[model samples]
Target: MISNPAKEREVRPAPPDPALDGLLTLSSAQVLVLASGGCHSGYAGDLCCCLLAAVQGALTASSYAQSHILAPGQALALYQCGEFSIQSVGEGVCMLVQLQGDLPGRLLASRLTDSAAFFPRGGAAVREAVLSLSVLEDEHALVSGTAASSYAYTMLTNLISGPSSEAVIGQGEPLSPLVEAAVGIIQEEFPFLEGLDELAERLEVSKAHLIRTFTKQTGISPGRYITHTRVEYAKLLLRGVDPSITYVAEASGFANANYFAKVFRRETGMSPSEYMEITPRKEPPKRDPFLW
Candidate 1:
C-alpha cells in the first residue's frame, strides 16, 4: 500500500495566467504550460516576445494569416506585434517563455529576418532547454527569481546563436510513417498499450526491427518511450487535487501500485508522495475562447 504524502506540505495555488498586455513589464522570464487542446492568444501591440516550443505531441501556431505545425523539438518566436494564437494539436505539452524588453531581438537579430519566424529545423537545443525549464517549474525548484531569469536568458541566447551540431537525430528530420504512427499510438493510448511486442505487431514489424528503428531515429527505445509517456501521464494526474496513487498507477499503465512506485522512483528519484509535496495543485480544467 502507498502512503499519502499530500498532507505533508501546503499546496501552492496555481499561478495566475499572465496578461498578454502586461507581458512587456515583466522583470523576469515567465514560463507557461499549454495543456492538450488549450489555446492562448495575444492581441497586436503587446510589446513582448515569446518562444513557443513543443515538448510533447505537437502544436499549431497561427498569425498574420499563416499557420504552422510544430512537432516535438520544433519552435517558433512571436513578437506579439500582430494578433496570434497557439493551440495544442492533441495531447500536447508546450512551453511558452515570455521575455521582457528586446531580449529576444538581441538574441535572434542575426537569424530572424522577420520578427515572427518559424524555426522548423535545428531547435533541438532550444527544446531541451525549455524542457529543463518545464521540469524546474514542475518540481518547484525555481525559488530564486534571479536564477530563473538567468537560466531563461541563457537558454534563449543559446537557441539563436549556439552551435548547430546535434548528437542525436536532427530536430528538423521528418519522422518516418511507421515511427510517426508508433509515437501517436504511444501518446494517445499509453494506458492501454500492452508492450513493445504489441506495438510491433500493430506496426507490422518484428520486435527487434521496431527496437532498432525507434532507437535509431528517436534516440530512445520503444519500451523506454512508453515508460516515459506513462510516467508523464502519472505526473499530470498527481498534480490534480488529492489524487490516489493506486488509481494513478492503474491509469498510467502500471500493472500494480508497487511496480508503479518502483518505476516512478527509478525515473524521477522520488516516490509519488514526495513528488506531490513539491508540485503545485493544478486548477480545474476550463476551455479557452481562442481554440481553433
Candidate 2:
C-alpha cells in the first residue's frame, strides 16, 4: 500500500534468504493497519494490531528488518539473520487501513459495507474500516463501484480486520496483481480442500504459485494460511465447546479428529480442549468509549 502494487515486493526473494523485505502501513492511530498471513500455518501470522500507543517501531523480529511506521517510513526485518533461519513471521503479507485511534484497541466501531466478509478465509461477518484520505472522509464514505468490485475491495480490508465493530479506511492504491489474485483464491476456494494438493487444484494454481502469492500479499504460505484458519475455528470450538470436537474437526477442514488434535497442540502449545482451559474462552469485549 505504501508503494504501488505493481511495484515489486522490495523484500527478500522466494526461497529462504537473509534479506527479505516485507511492508505494511499505518496512517493514524484512529485508522488501523493489520498484517495477517495464512490462518493456521505454523509460520503464517493471523491479524495483529499496529502499535497504537508509541510512535516508534511497533514490533520486530530482528534489528536489520524493522518497520519504521510513522505516517509512512517502513522496513522489513527478516529472521534469516544468521546462517540458521527461523521461518519468518509475516513473510507473506499484511494490510493497512486508515483507522480511528479515537477508539481504543480493536473495537470494530462501524462497517462501511454489509454484504462482504472481512476475512478472505470465509464467513459473512461485518467489520469496521478506516478509509484513505483520498477516498473521502477517513471514517465516512461508502465503498462504491460494482457489487463484485466493491465486495472484493472491501473483502481485502475486511480480511485484515475481520467482522467486528472496527475502524478501517480503504484509500490506498489498488493491491498488487499477485496479492489480488492470491487473496481471491483464499476467499473463494479454501473451504473445499481435502489436502494441500487438492486445494491447489481448486485455484487452478500450482502449489508453488499459491504459496508465493499468499506470502507476498498476506506474509505467509497458503498451506499455513489454511492451517491458521482451521486452527482459529478449532480454538473457538475448543473454548466454546458449543460444537463437539468431531464437528469442529470437520468444520475446521480436518479430515480426522486425531490429526487435528496433534496439529492443534503443536500450533497452540496445547490440545484443543487443553487450550481452552488455560487461555479462557471469550472474545475480548468491545471497548466502552464512555469509560475512558
Candidate 3:
C-alpha cells in the first residue's frame, strides 16, 4: 500500500546543494513553465507546504501517491508535500509557492487537507490571483528591491485569505502515455476489449507487458478501470429515460442484464434499482466561468 504522506509532519533535511537550496527557499518562490509533455519530478526536501496553480493548458500531477489533472483556472492545495511529479498535458505553466511559515499551514488547513479537491470553475479567482503573482515574478528583475519583494509577499498572503472551501483531495499517480492510450481504447470500446490479448494487440505490446505496465502506472489493473467505467456509464443510463436494465446493460457494453446487475452491485454496493432510487440524475456540468 502507498503510505499516506500527509499524516507525517517530519521535514527531510535540505541537501547540500546551493542552487537547489536557493531555488526551494527563495523569498520569491520559483515560477516553472513547462512545455507540452514536460515534467518536474523530485523530492520536496524542507519545503512541505505549497500552492499549485495552473496558468495555461492542462497539468497532470502526482504527489504523495495521489494524482490529479488541473486545467486552466484551477489550483490545488498540496501539503505534507514530498516527491511530487507534475507533467504538462499540453503547454502549461505552474507556480510553486513554497510555504515558509506557520501561517501558510494554518491558512491551508482551514481550506483543505492533504486530500482537498477543487472544481474547475470554482478556482477561477484563485488561479487569476496566482497568475498575477507569476507576472510579478517575471518583472521582479526589472525592479529588484525591497518594494518588489514586499509586494510579492503581500500577494501570496492575500491568496490564502480568500474563500478556501472549494478545495478537494487529489489522489493517485499520473498514467504514462502508453497506459493512458490503452485506457482510452478500453473506455471507448468496452465491449470489444474483451481480454488482455485484444488490449495488447491494440496497444502493440505483449499481453503480459501491457498488464504489468498499465497496472504499475495507474495503480489499478486495466481490466478493473474498464469495468468501473462501464458501471459508471450504466448508472448514468439507469438514472435517465432509458429505464430498461437490458438496454442500459447493452449500451454500457455488457452482454446481458443479469451480468450487468451483478457487476453493478459488486462495484456500487447496491442493486441497480436501489441505486437509481437513492441517486439523483446527474446533469451536464455547467461551463466553467473561469474558462474563457
Model 3 poorest 10 in a row by lDDT = 1-10
RMSD of 1: 11.7
Report clash pairs, candidate 1: none
lDDT of 1 by residue, 85-142 (tens): 8887775655566655444555566665446766653243343333334444556744
Give all candidates' CA lDDT scores: 0.60, 0.35, 0.54
What is the TM-score of each predicted model, taking all chains together?
Answer: 0.50, 0.38, 0.38
Per-residue lDDT over 60-80 for candidate 3, one digit per residue giving the tens place of the 0 to 100 score = 878885788886546675665
Weakest lDDT window of 10 consecutive positions for candidate 2: 4-13
Q: Per-residue error at 249 for model 1, in Å? A: 23
lDDT of 2 by residue, 1-292 (tens): 0122111111111221111111122222122222332121111122222221111112222222332221111212112122111122332222222211222122322321211112222232111122122222322332222211222223233344433211111234455765555444443233345555765676577878767765665556667766665676455445431236665676556877898899898887888777767854432122342244
Model 3: pairs clashing at backbone N, Cα or C within 3 Å:
66-171, 66-172, 67-171, 67-172, 115-169, 116-168, 116-169, 117-167, 117-168, 117-169
C-alpha-based local distance difference test score of model 2: 0.35
Span of ten consecutive residues with least summed lDDT in model 1: 4-13
- Identify the leading candidate in terms of lDDT: 1
- List CA RMSD, all candidates: 11.7, 19.0, 17.8
Off by over 4 Å in 1: 1-38, 43-47, 121-142, 162-175, 180-206, 212-292
